[model samples]
Target chain A: MATDLMSNGNRPSAEDIAARRKVIEVDRLDFAFGARQVLFDISLDVREGEIMVVMGGSGSGKTTLLRHLVGLMPPQPGKVKLLDKDMGALNRRQLLDLKRRIGVAFQFGALFSSLTVAENVKLPLRELTDLEERTMDIMANMKLEVCNLSGFGHLMPADLSGGMMKRASIARAIVMDPKLVFLDEPSSGLDPAVSSALDDLILKLRDAMDISVVVVSHDIESAFKIADRITILDKGRILISDRVDAVRNSPNERVQNLLHRRSEQIDVDPTEYLRRLAGD
Target chain B: MANPAKFFEQIGRRTASGLDEMGYATVLFFEAIYWTLTGWRQRQPVRIAATFAAMVEIGVAALPIATLLAATIGLMLAIQSLYSLGIFGAEQYAFIGIALSVVREFSPMIMGILIAGRSGSAIAARLATMNINQEIDALQVMGINPNRFLVAPVLIALVVMMPCLAMWANIVSILAAGLYVSAELNQSFGAYLNDTLDVLKVDDVWHGLGKAGLFGIIIALVGVVNGSMVKGGAEGVGRVTTRSVVLSVTLIVVADMIFAYLTTR
Candidate 1:
């Protein structure tokens, strides 16, 4: 049962999985904003055609780690290699070229408000390809259709509901047919049913597109549903990186607290509490 | 009392940050210029449609207010100059003074200030909102340079439109002053117009247009710099919008003063 769950009954053997290419590799990455450290000694990887979910509570630096993977923030005191190319070592032109082979869907669906939904999806194509206008339009509509957003291309992003907007954002992310895709909080702010649907969509996307996916999320249910492997973070440090079943049965008290949705118990000192209340 | 070391440290930090901002703005300005010239060669050509839309937004939309303000300045110039020159019984020469000042100085300066408040604030707010939404970051991830895709078209449009608006202001202001002075002197409007034309040199018109272009560059660079540097979300956008306007206006005035000093010397 554990093997079936881990391999999804159809995936390659353990040896084959181990031999698969690493689409994303992070080694001892650390990040800081001013004097405040956000990510500490983080190391993880996403194998080709696998869905890797990086999950954590709020302020655990999940988003910060995702940013480093996408090359939005440089890895300080460490290295991030995407598709075997070192992110920190790439020049501007090299980085741009590398970026073309990956897609990132931001948490908030970050579509350009001024453009129509179709135009928003087509932006990368328009900016990076010299394709004919008609061809670009067709390609954009096709991607939108894949996200179940067909026939809604003419509307502005402002006109779409939250779900439709997120779907459209995913369409834009995959418009370039990238080998790797990063989704920031893909199921955030959705109803349970909708969230489940999004998880299914992600799994379907990875299988159909043959692309590796990195999802930064706090939604444990969605992560369990879609993630082949999960990396749980706490306070800017990785607590567990393993298969879903192993993570579920882990003996770590913090892991159990997170997995069971148990609220953290804090033994607040009376003097500190009083001082905090008094604004001292 | 402030600790001397702390005070010095604060000053040093501020000066360093200020210099860093100036350097970034300088690079952004030159990059905009470079992209404006060469962006067409890229996979995504420089968007002429976007540039035209910005021209309509920054220039055509401001036309009515600019004309009204120019006419008011002209009327005020006529009244005040006439009063002063009237003491010397030289009120008849007020048109010459108005023509020289409006054509060479006031028109461009007033238009620059107006644009700083109007379009400069708008540019800053728009870009800052985009930044807050992560649209700029999204653009970078998509291999689209925001400077090429967003800033260059706006810079090009403003540089083209500012001189055009300034020329219109010059005409309107001079005409307003002409009509007022002709009626006051009980002379024909045609005679006053002729006097004005006679006093104004082509050099003065070109000088004002040149200043208008410089002010356009200042406003665009300031807005882009402030917008791109915004943090802390919506409040940050509002803060940068105000800063863009204030900084553009102050810089325009200072640049005008420097130009005046250089030309007169």
Candidate 2:
């Protein structure tokens, strides 16, 4: 009865996307690339001023789902409303306006290798605003400082370590102090320590800036450690979308297998198997 | 008990998505055009110097070699055509025929091919390197247009260089063809110059120059677009670099043929 009830509620309520001015609300999204469906009926919400981590295995539509949220890729089969506007329905002027309110740290850090860190930080400010040199510099310094990268402004992104580079990218993303920030695989190539430091920086940014944060990552430890809430996906369906602790303790076999790497999933434990067979 | 209405709604949503991507692609192309022009302010000196240097490299500096090739080809073709005409006792019209045909047809086509091979390859390689290094994405994330930053200078530079190159090729071919006829065929230099002048008009040369300018843009745009999209490891960059030159050349030839048909007719 509970399963039937849950399935019946899959349809988004009339007020679901239209209600609150959520930072992001994905309503029953179904996405496919021709015959290969990547996401199926994914319904979720990213509230204002909260850190929501969308975690899943590789090829589980983590990045694809994030792209839809950021307006880089339009939502398919349902609406992805960001800040109360459907991303798919925005006009050119409105889209630009909407994009200005968000920041994205792409999977690769996406820093312009040609420009120095200072110039990279200077980009959004220069293009979108009329701030004077000193003001822009001040803002750039503040963002860099937030990322713990103040003195190294003039250095190229190539000069930074993997962790530092990601921080710099994060700094660039938030230079606009956007209402929403999206990060795709923030800890992909970094060491554990560096990854933890990045998590600390993310938490610091969320609290300090008071902005909604959505991170798309496949790293299990990093996800569990930093995610306030975890949305686990398998085969394009949401296996679990709840608090990290609740999802951790859930009884769903698929969710359990994903979260707790299913030791009994294989043949038997070596010692137990040996003892039982030997006794026989 | 089934949401059959939901199924058709899904199809409509997919259709809308395809249209949105098409719209974004169009927007990106124009943004690239606008950005290339304004991106100059981002890195003023180096960007300006690099573009100016590309113009000099492609236009003024390559003039001598380009002229030599055009002239040599003109001489060989003129000689061969005159020999064939001489069999029908139309040998005396060699200067008129060669001057018109070479200046109007071959000059622009050769210039297009040369620019596509040299400048196009250089552009593709540079864009590929920029892409590999993440500079293009950097510009985009920064809200600065990479097209404005990278493509604009090359596009502007190519449009300027191509006409000048074609003119240089025209002059060189005419001079070499004149010398060849004067020394070997015992045709007077003054006679060769006058006959050629009578057959070739300002419009013919201008039309050919116009084609060269358009062809330059085609080649440069092709190089930049292909190069900017290069991804993965070194092999990916190499593959796109090769594709840039090949595609540019192919487009140039096809464009030239169409332009030639239109103008000559």
Candidate 3:
């Protein structure tokens, strides 16, 4: 298993290390929405064929960071390099071409409501490839099977359960066989068994297709289970980024607190609280 | 003094925002046109399919309403003109007046307004929903040009279909008016047809069709622009869709006035 080989430091073996290269490089990424700063000088690297789980609490800027990585939001006061090309520097055409190699599965599936599941899965192929209709259909079904939704492609997005929707979205995301896949909260809003099965599917995808996977999730158990490396974000800053074992054994107070599900409490002054309540 | 200053400030802000929206719409219009022409040259399947679907929605599906409105308006116009013209002993001239009005003005203007309300609002709502659902972002992430995929097809369909709808409306309206003149007004059907044919020039037909085409372009632009600019979520989509209908109707009227003035001169 891939995890067995990386159990030491979660680093690829020397023989495998030579074959892997950085696919995504984020340097000094600082983002702000109007007056509120969201991401603060964050940096990270994703290797060619690894599952990197980005975990954060609500409002921790995990989704914002994912958006920046996928070029949905531009890098301001920072740099992001994808496939060795600077995202900030790419023209519209170049950026579009780059997007063809990257697949993003949004949290809510984001499938076209007017199109059936088979149509939704075949959309990328229809738009980007010259494949025959039969070939596209076959390919879409193959992907649906991989996501454990083989026969469900005939249904519409509204007809599917939450877990089914997520799986269908994953199927659509992988239909094009993209070099990089970004799954946003794939296991979110799902039962433990379904989520675990999804985690296994993610692992199988990375191992079989040799594609890099960047998953933004708050599901700690799933993150710990599937990630070769885990990056924890808190309050718009990265708390820790290390191998799964290293993260598990880390001595950092905040990291330990997070792993143990401990919440922090802040003492409030009575006068200040009263003043705020009085609309001062 | 402060109140007056605030009023002027508000006016200035509104003007600036309106101009900004117009500028954005203009850019979108040109981009949609560019993509459509390029895609046609390249024989892009997605653009072709979208164009066909839009044509069915904007043209074929809208025919019944367009015809109904035209026929009712034509009957009303003939009745009103006959009542007034009868006082002057010029009731025989009602055919000429109705023909000229329906062919050069009412059919195209009413058709444009109806389509702006029906198809334009629908386009805005559909695109706005897609915007709120993150489907627009999904399209962008998949290397698909949203404008080429969404707007260009509708624009092409509207431009092609609006004039045809107007022409159909003109024909139905004239026929309905002729029926009233012959049956209710006690005028001979042959004489009424002759009077209408004598006054209705080819130029009148072209002018109405031209105005309809321009109004179609306006409706498409306003719908797409408002939809693409939608922020927030479901509430935003609702707001923009309503605004698109109101703005499209206003723009169509404005364009009609401009065309009327220029063509007359």
Candidate 4:
């Protein structure tokens, strides 16, 4: 795919040109669901061949941001450029064409219940490529092996445990050798041992395939372990987006609170509390 | 006075929602049509496999129920016509009434309603489950058009098989009615056969089959559109599945009425 020229049509500055080389870029993105604004002026970038972990509390708009990156949700008030093309400018065909180079493992694994793990992994290649069936099968098995799900390929999604299903979902996501992959809550429901192993697998995939990864997770240990950079969001706003060490050392109170898992004390007015209880 | 503003507001909301639903169904219908026509050029094996699977599910599987409905209705119609016409000493024309009604209206309408309830609800529920589970999103992320991958095969199956099912229903109903008239109603076999042949025309069969084909498209559109729009979870799936059945039956009935009027005219 040819890199699309920037929409501004102006010659980019040196720093701007450097930023263009990044695999994913979001500039002042704002998103709302109905009357509720969920992502407020969110800005971040994921550089090539790096894992960028997006961490947030529940309902902090991490999934919404991921949706925008993958073209499921359109930009509302800001820019999301992926793979050197403006996401807002692409037509349906162009968006789909661009999606071929991207992979997403959803929060729940999201494997097709009707198909076996092997068939699920083979779906991308089968739909988008002219590869022979034998070759496709071989490639699917290879991906399953990569995700440590080799012999489990013949089983239906219902047959797999949570960790195994997540692995299978990862296998399917990376089967087509996407240049960029998005993983949502990969460690959410796993035991620490399995979660740690998944973290290692994620890093291994990055090194082996040289693919950029954007992971949305609330698992502090997994994020700190796997991310080259981390972006922490709180209440639809980014507290900090920087390298792991910088994030850990940041003076921002919210960042510190999040890093230390501190829950702030609430000071509610007595009159307001009484009014709420009285249904006023 | 009752809240006039709220009453109008409710009416306006319902009208808008109905229009929105119609638009969604229309867009899905055209997308299914476009994919079905161009799908051959792409030669996607999965698509072809889905198409065949749908054929077996929608067509072959519905055969027994369709046959039973047709036979039962045919027998009832024959008995009713014989008793009613016997009052005027016109019992010999019972086969004519039975054949005409079965071929021109009952077979297509009954089969349409039955398939709408069975297959339409099934399609909606399956798609709603896929949606809730995020498999649909997974397909979209993989650059696969979900409509092309899922809806086209179903559209093709329903359209092609609906007429075939109607034809089967037509035959079984006529045969069942013929038997009832000959043995139970004390009419001769030769008289029943001759009366049926005289009353039934090629145009009648074509009209019924054509109506059945339209009903098939209605069911496909309602099922897929409702399914694709499903949100929430298991409750949403059940709700949309029921809605798909109701909407499909309503649309089939309306379409059948139009076809009946045009054919009779």
- Report how closely model 1 matches the true complex, as a DockQ value: 0.81
lDDT of 4 by residue, B27-66 (tens): 8888877777775565433377788899899999999899
Per residue, candidate 3 scores C-alpha lDDT tens digits across A185-259 of 999899988887888888888877889999999887887777878999999999999877789889998888887
TM-score of 4: 0.92
Clashing pairs in 3: none
Number of the candidate with higher TM-score, 1 or 2: 1
lDDT of 4: 0.87
User: What docking tier does model 2 reach?
Assistant: incorrect
Q: Between 3 and 4, whose lDDT is larger?
A: 3
lDDT of 2 by residue, A112-144 (tens): 776798878877887667789999999999999
Instruction: State which candidate has the highest TM-score.
Output: 1
Best-fitting candidate, measured by lDDT? Answer: 1
Name the lDDT value of residue A10 in candidate 1: 34
Interface RMSD of each: 1.1, 4.7, 1.8, 1.7
Ranking by DockQ: 1, 3, 4, 2
The CA lDDT at B93 in model 4 is 78
> Clashing residue pairs, candidate 4?
none
